[model samples]
Target: MASASTANRWLRPEVYPLFAAVGVAVGICGFQLVRNICINPEVRVSKEGRSAGVLENYAEGEKYAEHGLRKFLRTRAPEIMPSINRFFADPK
Candidate 1:
Protein backbone atom coordinates (compact mmCIF):
# COMPACT_ATOMS: atom_id res chain seq x y z
CA MET A 1 0.00 0.00 0.00
CA ALA A 2 1.06 3.62 -0.34
CA SER A 3 1.41 4.05 3.40
CA ALA A 4 3.77 1.05 3.64
CA SER A 5 5.98 2.39 0.85
CA THR A 6 6.15 5.76 2.54
CA ALA A 7 7.47 4.09 5.71
CA ASN A 8 10.47 2.88 3.74
CA ARG A 9 11.42 6.47 3.08
CA TRP A 10 12.84 6.61 6.59
CA LEU A 11 15.65 4.33 5.40
CA ARG A 12 16.91 7.01 3.03
CA PRO A 13 20.26 8.82 3.67
CA GLU A 14 18.65 12.13 4.59
CA VAL A 15 16.93 10.52 7.59
CA TYR A 16 20.05 8.83 8.97
CA PRO A 17 20.90 11.73 11.24
CA LEU A 18 17.36 11.78 12.61
CA PHE A 19 17.71 8.11 13.44
CA ALA A 20 21.11 8.71 15.07
CA ALA A 21 19.74 11.58 17.16
CA VAL A 22 16.89 9.47 18.44
CA GLY A 23 19.32 6.66 19.25
CA VAL A 24 21.48 8.99 21.30
CA ALA A 25 18.49 10.40 23.18
CA VAL A 26 17.24 6.91 23.99
CA GLY A 27 20.66 5.75 25.08
CA ILE A 28 21.10 8.67 27.45
CA CYS A 29 17.67 8.15 28.94
CA GLY A 30 18.39 4.45 29.49
CA PHE A 31 21.76 5.20 31.06
CA GLN A 32 20.23 7.80 33.36
CA LEU A 33 17.47 5.45 34.42
CA VAL A 34 19.94 2.78 35.37
CA ARG A 35 22.29 5.16 37.10
CA ASN A 36 19.46 6.64 39.18
CA ILE A 37 18.47 3.22 40.51
CA CYS A 38 21.76 1.47 41.20
CA ILE A 39 23.28 4.30 43.18
CA ASN A 40 20.83 3.78 46.08
CA PRO A 41 21.34 2.04 49.50
CA GLU A 42 24.26 4.28 50.47
CA VAL A 43 26.82 2.26 48.59
CA ARG A 44 29.70 4.07 46.94
CA VAL A 45 30.84 2.82 43.56
CA SER A 46 33.55 3.72 41.11
CA LYS A 47 32.83 4.86 37.58
CA GLU A 48 33.79 1.61 35.90
CA GLY A 49 32.07 -0.53 38.53
CA ARG A 50 28.75 1.08 37.70
CA SER A 51 28.27 -0.89 34.48
CA ALA A 52 25.91 -3.32 36.27
CA GLY A 53 24.66 -1.03 39.02
CA VAL A 54 21.37 -0.32 37.28
CA LEU A 55 20.16 -3.83 38.09
CA GLU A 56 20.66 -3.18 41.77
CA ASN A 57 18.65 0.00 41.47
CA TYR A 58 15.81 -1.88 39.82
CA ALA A 59 15.67 -4.30 42.72
CA GLU A 60 15.65 -1.50 45.23
CA GLY A 61 12.98 0.22 43.23
CA GLU A 62 10.83 -2.89 43.52
CA LYS A 63 10.93 -2.63 47.31
CA TYR A 64 10.10 1.03 47.15
CA ALA A 65 7.12 0.21 44.97
CA GLU A 66 5.54 -2.14 47.50
CA HIS A 67 3.33 0.72 48.68
CA GLY A 68 1.65 1.28 45.31
CA LEU A 69 3.20 0.63 41.94
CA ARG A 70 1.62 3.29 39.77
CA LYS A 71 1.43 5.99 42.41
CA PHE A 72 4.94 5.47 43.79
CA LEU A 73 6.49 5.34 40.34
CA ARG A 74 5.44 8.93 39.76
CA THR A 75 5.79 10.50 43.23
CA ARG A 76 8.40 8.88 45.44
CA ALA A 77 10.82 7.47 42.90
CA PRO A 78 12.98 10.54 43.19
CA GLU A 79 13.53 9.81 46.88
CA ILE A 80 16.00 7.11 45.92
CA MET A 81 18.07 9.40 43.74
CA PRO A 82 19.91 11.14 46.54
CA SER A 83 20.39 7.98 48.57
CA ILE A 84 21.63 6.13 45.51
CA ASN A 85 24.08 8.87 44.65
CA ARG A 86 25.40 8.87 48.19
CA PHE A 87 25.93 5.15 48.10
CA PHE A 88 27.45 5.17 44.66
CA ALA A 89 29.78 8.02 45.55
CA ASP A 90 31.20 6.32 48.62
CA PRO A 91 34.75 4.94 48.44
CA LYS A 92 34.85 1.20 48.49
Candidate 2:
Protein backbone atom coordinates (compact mmCIF):
# COMPACT_ATOMS: atom_id res chain seq x y z
CA MET A 1 0.00 0.00 0.00
CA ALA A 2 1.29 3.50 -0.83
CA SER A 3 2.20 5.84 1.99
CA ALA A 4 0.07 9.02 2.34
CA SER A 5 2.83 11.18 0.86
CA THR A 6 3.35 8.75 -1.98
CA ALA A 7 -0.38 8.73 -2.78
CA ASN A 8 -0.39 12.48 -2.83
CA ARG A 9 2.63 12.54 -5.12
CA TRP A 10 0.90 10.13 -7.48
CA LEU A 11 -1.94 12.60 -8.13
CA ARG A 12 -1.65 14.21 -11.55
CA PRO A 13 -0.40 17.83 -11.69
CA GLU A 14 -3.16 18.59 -14.26
CA VAL A 15 -5.74 18.31 -11.47
CA TYR A 16 -4.23 21.40 -9.80
CA PRO A 17 -5.33 23.70 -12.61
CA LEU A 18 -8.86 22.30 -12.50
CA PHE A 19 -9.01 22.87 -8.75
CA ALA A 20 -7.72 26.43 -9.16
CA ALA A 21 -10.28 27.17 -11.84
CA VAL A 22 -13.09 25.92 -9.60
CA GLY A 23 -11.77 28.01 -6.69
CA VAL A 24 -11.71 31.18 -8.83
CA ALA A 25 -15.28 30.56 -10.08
CA VAL A 26 -16.53 30.05 -6.51
CA GLY A 27 -14.73 33.22 -5.31
CA ILE A 28 -16.28 35.29 -8.12
CA CYS A 29 -19.76 33.97 -7.33
CA GLY A 30 -19.32 34.77 -3.62
CA PHE A 31 -18.09 38.31 -4.37
CA GLN A 32 -21.01 39.00 -6.69
CA LEU A 33 -23.51 37.68 -4.10
CA VAL A 34 -22.03 39.87 -1.34
CA ARG A 35 -21.94 42.97 -3.57
CA ASN A 36 -25.55 42.46 -4.64
CA ILE A 37 -26.71 42.07 -1.04
CA CYS A 38 -24.76 45.10 0.21
CA ILE A 39 -25.63 47.53 -2.60
CA ASN A 40 -29.17 46.64 -3.59
CA PRO A 41 -30.87 49.55 -5.38
CA GLU A 42 -33.70 49.68 -2.81
CA VAL A 43 -31.27 51.47 -0.45
CA ARG A 44 -29.79 53.76 -3.13
CA VAL A 45 -31.98 56.71 -2.26
CA SER A 46 -30.83 56.63 1.37
CA LYS A 47 -27.21 56.41 0.29
CA GLU A 48 -27.64 59.33 -2.09
CA GLY A 49 -29.32 61.39 0.63
CA ARG A 50 -26.43 60.76 3.02
CA SER A 51 -23.87 61.69 0.38
CA ALA A 52 -25.84 64.83 -0.51
CA GLY A 53 -25.97 65.88 3.14
CA VAL A 54 -22.19 65.52 3.36
CA LEU A 55 -21.81 67.64 0.25
CA GLU A 56 -24.20 70.26 1.62
CA ASN A 57 -22.17 70.53 4.82
CA TYR A 58 -19.21 71.63 2.69
CA ALA A 59 -21.26 73.85 0.39
CA GLU A 60 -19.63 77.08 1.56
CA GLY A 61 -16.14 75.73 0.90
CA GLU A 62 -17.14 74.45 -2.54
CA LYS A 63 -18.85 77.73 -3.39
CA TYR A 64 -15.74 79.74 -2.47
CA ALA A 65 -13.50 77.46 -4.48
CA GLU A 66 -15.84 77.61 -7.46
CA HIS A 67 -15.91 81.40 -7.34
CA GLY A 68 -12.14 81.55 -7.12
CA LEU A 69 -11.76 79.23 -10.11
CA ARG A 70 -14.24 81.25 -12.15
CA LYS A 71 -12.46 84.51 -11.33
CA PHE A 72 -9.06 83.01 -12.16
CA LEU A 73 -10.34 81.71 -15.52
CA ARG A 74 -12.01 85.02 -16.32
CA THR A 75 -8.77 86.85 -15.65
CA ARG A 76 -6.81 84.44 -17.85
CA ALA A 77 -9.42 84.07 -20.59
CA PRO A 78 -7.54 86.19 -23.08
CA GLU A 79 -4.45 83.99 -22.75
CA ILE A 80 -6.27 80.64 -22.71
CA MET A 81 -9.25 81.12 -25.03
CA PRO A 82 -7.18 81.74 -28.16
CA SER A 83 -5.22 78.52 -27.75
CA ILE A 84 -8.41 76.55 -27.11
CA ASN A 85 -10.15 78.06 -30.11
CA ARG A 86 -7.16 77.35 -32.35
CA PHE A 87 -6.94 73.75 -31.16
CA PHE A 88 -10.62 73.09 -31.82
CA ALA A 89 -10.75 74.90 -35.12
CA ASP A 90 -8.63 72.39 -37.05
CA PRO A 91 -7.49 69.01 -35.76
CA LYS A 92 -5.14 68.41 -38.69
Candidate 3:
Protein backbone atom coordinates (compact mmCIF):
# COMPACT_ATOMS: atom_id res chain seq x y z
CA MET A 1 0.00 0.00 0.00
CA ALA A 2 1.07 3.63 -0.48
CA SER A 3 2.35 5.61 2.49
CA ALA A 4 -0.24 7.74 4.47
CA SER A 5 1.43 11.09 3.69
CA THR A 6 1.53 10.34 -0.01
CA ALA A 7 -2.17 9.39 -0.03
CA ASN A 8 -3.11 12.58 1.88
CA ARG A 9 -1.13 14.79 -0.47
CA TRP A 10 -3.00 13.36 -3.43
CA LEU A 11 -6.39 13.80 -1.74
CA ARG A 12 -6.00 17.34 -0.38
CA PRO A 13 -5.88 19.19 -3.70
CA GLU A 14 -8.87 17.28 -5.03
CA VAL A 15 -10.97 18.06 -1.95
CA TYR A 16 -10.03 21.75 -1.76
CA PRO A 17 -11.91 22.77 -4.93
CA LEU A 18 -15.01 20.82 -3.87
CA PHE A 19 -14.98 22.58 -0.50
CA ALA A 20 -14.55 26.00 -2.16
CA ALA A 21 -17.47 25.38 -4.55
CA VAL A 22 -19.72 24.33 -1.71
CA GLY A 23 -18.80 27.44 0.26
CA VAL A 24 -19.66 29.72 -2.69
CA ALA A 25 -23.03 27.98 -3.19
CA VAL A 26 -23.90 28.31 0.49
CA GLY A 27 -23.02 32.01 0.45
CA ILE A 28 -25.22 32.65 -2.59
CA CYS A 29 -28.18 30.80 -1.04
CA GLY A 30 -27.83 32.73 2.20
CA PHE A 31 -27.80 36.05 0.35
CA GLN A 32 -30.91 35.14 -1.66
CA LEU A 33 -32.80 34.13 1.49
CA VAL A 34 -31.99 37.41 3.19
CA ARG A 35 -32.95 39.45 0.12
CA ASN A 36 -36.30 37.69 -0.22
CA ILE A 37 -37.09 38.22 3.44
CA CYS A 38 -36.13 41.88 3.33
CA ILE A 39 -38.29 42.50 0.29
CA ASN A 40 -41.33 40.72 1.71
CA PRO A 41 -44.38 41.89 -0.28
CA GLU A 42 -46.85 41.35 2.54
CA VAL A 43 -45.31 44.11 4.58
CA ARG A 44 -45.68 46.62 1.77
CA VAL A 45 -49.33 45.77 1.17
CA SER A 46 -50.24 45.88 4.83
CA LYS A 47 -48.58 49.24 5.44
CA GLU A 48 -49.43 50.94 2.14
CA GLY A 49 -52.88 49.46 1.40
CA ARG A 50 -51.69 48.29 -1.99
CA SER A 51 -51.05 44.91 -3.52
CA ALA A 52 -47.34 44.21 -3.61
CA GLY A 53 -47.58 40.87 -5.36
CA VAL A 54 -46.14 40.30 -8.80
CA LEU A 55 -49.47 40.94 -10.51
CA GLU A 56 -51.37 44.10 -9.60
CA ASN A 57 -55.13 44.25 -9.27
CA TYR A 58 -55.74 46.57 -12.18
CA ALA A 59 -59.26 45.25 -12.73
CA GLU A 60 -60.34 46.64 -9.38
CA GLY A 61 -59.42 50.20 -10.42
CA GLU A 62 -56.02 50.10 -8.73
CA LYS A 63 -53.02 51.34 -10.69
CA TYR A 64 -50.85 48.66 -12.24
CA ALA A 65 -47.48 48.28 -10.64
CA GLU A 66 -44.43 46.81 -12.27
CA HIS A 67 -42.06 44.57 -10.37
CA GLY A 68 -39.33 46.37 -8.44
CA LEU A 69 -36.52 44.92 -10.51
CA ARG A 70 -38.11 45.86 -13.82
CA LYS A 71 -38.89 49.34 -12.67
CA PHE A 72 -35.37 49.88 -11.42
CA LEU A 73 -33.82 48.58 -14.60
CA ARG A 74 -36.01 50.69 -16.83
CA THR A 75 -35.31 53.88 -14.93
CA ARG A 76 -31.59 53.22 -14.45
CA ALA A 77 -30.63 51.80 -17.82
CA PRO A 78 -29.28 55.10 -19.11
CA GLU A 79 -27.11 55.52 -16.04
CA ILE A 80 -25.95 51.92 -15.99
CA MET A 81 -24.90 51.56 -19.64
CA PRO A 82 -22.11 54.10 -19.37
CA SER A 83 -20.53 52.34 -16.41
CA ILE A 84 -20.81 48.97 -18.11
CA ASN A 85 -19.28 50.33 -21.33
CA ARG A 86 -16.40 51.88 -19.44
CA PHE A 87 -15.66 48.61 -17.64
CA PHE A 88 -15.53 46.66 -20.92
CA ALA A 89 -13.50 49.23 -22.91
CA ASP A 90 -9.89 48.68 -23.94
CA PRO A 91 -7.50 49.79 -21.20
CA LYS A 92 -4.96 51.21 -23.66
Determine the backbone clash count of candidate 3: 0
Residue range 1-92, candidate 1, lDDT tens digits = 98888988767899999999999999999986786666444343666655545454666656554545567577654665777887888778
Q: Given candidate 3, what's the lDDT at residue 42? A: 34
TM-score of model 3 (CA atoms): 0.36
- Leading candidate by lDDT: 1
Lowest lDDT sum, 10 consecutive residues, model 1, at 35-44
Steric clash pairs (candidate 2): none
lDDT of 1 at 17: 94
Regions of candidate 3 where Cα sits further than 4 Å from its true position: 1-11, 42-92
The parts of candidate 2 lying over 4 Å away from their true place are 1-11, 42-92
lDDT of 3 by residue, 1-92 (tens): 46988878757877888889989999999987785556644334254445444545355322223556667788764654786787878485
lDDT of 2 by residue, 3-86 (tens): 887768746696788888989999999986775555533223565555654343355455544665587777674654797798
Full candidate order by lDDT, most accurate first: 1, 2, 3
Judged by TM-score, which candidate is best?
1
Candidate 1: the clashing residue pairs are 37-57, 39-84, 40-84, 42-87, 43-87, 44-87, 44-90, 45-88
Cα RMSD, model 2: 14.6
